[model samples]
Target: AAQTDAWDGVRALRADYRTATGERREVVLGDGTVLSLNTGSAVNVRFDASRRLVELLAGEILVISGHGAGSGVPLEVATREGRVRALGTRFAVRQQDEYSTVDVFESAVEIRPRDGSGAPLLLAAGRGAAFCRHASGAPHAVGAYADAWSRGQLIVDDVTLGDFLAELARYRPGVIDCAPAVARLRLSGVFPLADTQRILNMLPNSLPVQVRSRTRYWVSVEPAS
Candidate 1:
């Protein structure tokens, strides 16, 4: 993909930040907004007199509004699908393939789709929603471990093996593939993000699966022999 300058408008100063695989980072904006970027995430910060905006070019961010200079300006996190306007709150936004997910942890947030086709939705505390270009899903209760990644942990609650591996792949440098035969196996555990290889090694003991490693950068989970 071609990289375009994020600060292309007049008087628009922008800063870009990114984290490589298996890394997490924090960024403080000029207006006192702290953003926690997850692994392999990228964000663009643009602040001016009129608006305070953080664009999620890729990945997820946990935003906490600060109360210092330039704090009164409403903070908005823009994704490909839409924008999440912080309403004196703390929230997290993740940019997905087809849509973006917003989870509110404190206060409320207003979501506006990019195409401006549907009514804007206000998500209150403890709620989450997904939105696309022209529509949005209704707000739902926040999941048990929706924000656990920020703590360097993966909390699984009877989630499918494939789904768990898919999430785990986001934190590592290479492929972690699950064979089709074991994809539907159920799993529940707390896997530490600090050691992804250990997680792969321990899976076979707890489940009917085998972890095959072609190299450190390539691995696969298949039905146990």
Candidate 2:
């Protein structure tokens, strides 16, 4: 991507705060908005007295827009897929290889795809949009993502056990994998804020699986006896 107009600090191309290929960081913007960047993320900052823009290069970001930023000056987060103009909204964006997931927790946002979708997608609170890189998406419901972020819980609604575990591994750092024996197990319910332990402990009782903890950070799930 070519650089934007004259960047900060006399640099041709400027990124407000950038991380390497495998680094994660937390950035606090001048306007009081906080961005929690997942691994391999880069963001260009455009914060002034009037407008606020965050251009994400890669990875995931958890955003909490500050209160009372102004009346008409909305906050925006842009990525390779499109731009998100937040109307006093709190949302998160995850840009991966295949698609980008936009989860809205509060207020509303306008999602504009660069592929020339004249009608931008409007997502309200507790809604989400998944933009497929290869093709257009059906715009299904992802209320779980939005609700979970707000309540600080992980609600897996009838998802495959493998898929459930795969998601649980993201919040925490380490290698936590599921065995094939429990791959087909179906799961539901909520995992409270930062409480992977509680979820792991209850899995065996709720489903036909055996959850064995190798360590506090490492766990494995298999078919029950």
Q: What is the C-alpha RMSD of each candidate to the true structure, in Å?
A: 3.8, 6.0
Q: Write the per-residue lDDT of candidate 2 for residues 74-193, one digit (tens) a residue.
A: 789877677888877678887765567888778888888767546777888877777753333555565555435334567777899888887777656566678887797787887874
Off by over 4 Å in 2: 1-28, 32-44, 57-59, 62-64, 67-72, 132-136, 193-198, 212-219
TM-score each candidate: 0.90, 0.68
Q: What lDDT, from 0 to 1, does candidate 1 have?
A: 0.87
C-alpha RMSD (angstroms) for model 2: 6.0
lDDT of 1 by residue, 1-225 (tens): 123333322112233788778889988877677899998788888787777889887789999987667777888999888899999888999988678999999999999999976678999999999999888898899988988998899999999999999999998988998999999999899999989999999998899999999998999899999
Candidates in order have lDDT scores of 0.87, 0.70
Number of backbone collisions per candidate, in order? Answer: 0, 0
